[model samples]
Target chain A: MSTALSQKLDAVSGNASGGHRVNPGELDLSHKVILYLDGISVSFDGFKALNDLSLTIDAGELRAIIGPNGAGKTTMMDVITGKTRPDSGTAFFGQSLDLTRMNEPEIAHAGIGRKFQKPTIFEQLTVFENLELAMKTDKRVWKSLFAQLASDERDRVADTLQRIRLVDEADRLAGLLSHGQKQWLEIGMLLMQEPRLLLLDEPVAGMTDEETERTAELFVSLAGKHSLVVVEHDMAFVEALGGKVTVLHEGAVLAEGDLATVQNDARVIEVYLGR
Target chain B: MRTPLSVRMFQSLPRTAWLALAIFAAIAWIAIPAAHLLLPESSPFHVSAYTVTLLGKILCYAVVAVAMDLIWGYAGILSLGHGVFFALGGYAFGMYLMRQIGTDGSYGVALPDFMVFLDWKALPWFWVGSDSFLWALIMVVAVPGLLAFVFGWFAFRSRIKGVYFSIITQALTYATMLLFFRNETGFGGNNGFTDFKRILGYDITSPQMRLVLFGLSAALLIAVLILGRYLVTSKFGRVLAAIRDAESRVRFIGYQPTQYKLAIWTLSAVLCALAGALYVPQVGIINPSEMSPANSIEIAVWVAVGGRGTLIGGVIGAFIVNLAKSFFTVSFPDYWLFFLGFLFIGVTLFLPDGVVGLWRKLRGKRAIEDTDTPTETPADAKGASA
Candidate 1:
């Protein structure tokens, strides 16, 4: 047991040599798809939240999922992140890891990071501590109890602070940040894990126009390095992402293509973006 | 080189806290014992035996309160069954104390008086090692710690939390209390373990012995406080607070909440057990009444009244409420319950942060007024939110 743990620790530390960003130890992306879901269905009290929802996100590809209220956008994110178990279907990450078999933390440990619709950073902790808590270090009880942040880990956190534009507010309590700032801090927290796949739920729900544009830019920049599945209601933000868009009407995909292509689709127009 | 444990333990605390702790240790270890043992009986400054025992008992309770704060205040697990752990600790030590009676008991048999009264022929399998002080000390921590670990494992794995968790814990202690009340349980039934003659061959009721026990209790309380402080301020403590605030969020960030909760829960139970073990010797009795659900709720009340999250607040709260209880139970025994109820309600409603928070607030306001600086408003706002 001791040898097994030490070997696991050695593997993790070996991967850490690349930089502060945790390399998830070479994901088996030979299948070309980072995430694949087919015939996924989740029902709550006989009401289908996701029904036969089949979608695949390619490696390092950015995808936007847009839909009306109760259209299963958040449910899809939940299913992908292992928050909600699909009643029937296959959800795979990196061809081998069955996401359906995993729990939330396991899914997260499998290099899938998620941002909740509501900014849920630790409000009681400082902005720096918030990012520090999210760092890709040992999550075991004893390890965390004795673990100190290495200089590289500190540098990574400092870098994330600048990326999230919260450098000035690093020492401030996270609860005191503006709504837009809180959103960025939460994103920064996700980035600290150095996930292979990022699932964002309504990244710009309450952001101002400028904030929304900046978030779009952030997503665009993160796309090639990280697979991003951005679910949003803002059309301009989707266009700004300049990626394939998947539209959902009920629990299934209504249309799939670019923003203009989806906008022009008749079924998409009839159920959503009414002409 | 890795930092020493001593430095790491005191890293989060200011220098004044260290000084305060040192002063407290000096008083507890030296001054109080000196007053009780060395000072002239006619001297008003001399500490009385009753006072020593009372303070000693309260110190044990303070340790329990500190334990309570760790799980409830930091980990967001409200266990109302902590009395089970405390009583378990007491029973473990009580077994040794009962053995120390050593043919001096009522029936003058090898067995305890209660066992002889029940016509028990021999010690139960569970009581095999009860005669050894070392074994009893091990039981004091292990029994409660093991129970907590098993209970927390099942409860946390099933994701039982919030008021449901609280209710189940209450049920746990309630059931244990009922079980311990039965004569067949071999725990002295309702009377539990008492009538001790000696501990380690020292006269059990000696003033010097009492002072030694008192000193041990005080030292344990201080140790627990420092340990609790170290834990709550470490990275582990930060994650614990995060779990308290948002459990699901912690899960999404790749942390197993159950493990964290279970670890702290077990640790807290062990602390409570240690407190209990110390308590039995000073108080001279261990009974099923300690496992009563009401007793466990009182433990929560001490943490709540003291200020839950602040480590020191727990010790302070334990001292304040127990002191009040000691005073009121004697002065107005009939109205003591009413006073305690009012105190709990008052703290919950008006002083949500407890006495510690109230102190900080007054000092904060005074500092702000004295400085008359506008820049301090943001800092105050941040403090208030945290």
Candidate 2:
């Protein structure tokens, strides 16, 4: 009945969509880099959360960032996802699109999705509905009112439910799910967005060993199709992911190598492990 | 081949819901009107004029309750400024009613008595088109819709939410009430608009006109329910629920919470304004007091008493509370406010999900027991907690 939102959306899509469109051509990863952060520094109340931090992720790479508390891991995710603006930094998605210039929804629309540290699935909604809400589609206010689930879209939800091992629990409210199930549901929701890069913060914090192993397998399998930047504190899960581990300390990278190599580094051992 | 519009509309509601609607329509459109207009005064089936007017007023309230539920229940936005929208609609239509008084006012002038009494030379610019019924109808929607859109745009854009949003809305209505109470604003001052003589060249107080307003109110409530049902059942509804639960999660999934919230908020306001327009013709008064913060709070109470997310709950709640109000104010006028306070407290304390949720829980438990399976225990537990 009201075209107010449609008009605003028209203005937004007209004014902001040009530079931020997610067309594959503009997402050019010919250099093989999916994410690039250079000289990023963020300070709050004069305490540096991130100082001169720079990192790069190869296309479709699963990058595990291991850091102690206050290592700027979450802040880094915030910056890339456009939640927090860094005081100084150039963050790029692929090569053409700038992450710092967009808002959270814009960054998400541009193919970057972030999962919070805690499991943040829509608890009141059924697992199926949660996935449906998160599914990649025209999310405009007016369009959503008449949107019917296409057969292919329904199949996509079913496929995701199977992949996330929540097929049996599809009808159940997500709040009723166990902690690990909620974690998986949140991941399934992220996958529904079809994000090019997935930033997961401590995704396996409360999972059982079996669930943790399963999640690790899922993340490993997801690599090469979806670039994952998993910020995890669980050493075992990180080891299970078996990807490149970047150890962060004092707001900067302390070590960069395989898990074995980082574990063996003298400085890494002194600051994080040797203690 | 696309489905026919009528067939699709019919299929929107389940058979049971349709039956319920049919029963309601029969009473509102056929039974009650027949009882009032056709039955002799001595007949037991004869409905009194006072009762018809009261029921008509409640029906108007029912429309407002449903609108409140759409935003507060479904969108998780608690707006205490909704009375402003309702009052705005009433005033918009009231202007037309005043103009229709023609040269019959005590001042014997073509201008409304208030304008003549205030020594105003002519109608205000805002009331220029107030003589046309079509203009009144347009203003009924446009006025509140515009206000809500502007207010909601700024509020939602700044991400003001939860209790803060509620407080701001309360302030909004309170301020509007104060503004309307001023004579300088040219809206009849504290007396507001009343003593209407006619509408569309027909007697406003005639039995036929009263029944017409009553039936229109019922139709509006029914339409609001159907539209609300269609909305909350769509993907948009699911996204709204998701936004309610986890707004940031919705943002990360690429949906702007502000746009969705603003759209629903404005729609809810427009619905309330329509209810108010219908309300003025039946109750025969439109005043600044209609925009009072307390009146808006009572609306939330109706939704909460019925169940927030369930559209039917708001209607049931409006009927329950208003009927109770009619009884209490007549019998114990002084304690009516106390009774309302206690009712709200009781509903909030013991019935968090409102009456509809309680009904669902009772039914769910019975079904669970009938099936009797260990796998259903979690669902049973969820019902209890929910």
Candidate with maximal lDDT: 2
What DockQ does model 1 achieve?
0.45
The fraction of reference interface contacts (C-alpha pairs within 8 A across chains A and B) present in each candidate is 0.66, 0.85
**B-chain TM-scores per prediction:** 0.93, 0.93
Backbone clash pairs for candidate 2 read A269-A274
lDDT of 1 by residue, B301-369 (tens): 998887878778788998998999999988999998898899999999998888887887887742111
Best by TM-score: 1
CAPRI classification of candidate 2: acceptable
Which parts of model 1 are misplaced by more than 4 Å?
Answer: A1-26, A273-275, B365-386
| lDDT of each residue in A16-76, candidate 1, tens digit only | 4353333343355655678889999999999999989999999789999998999998888
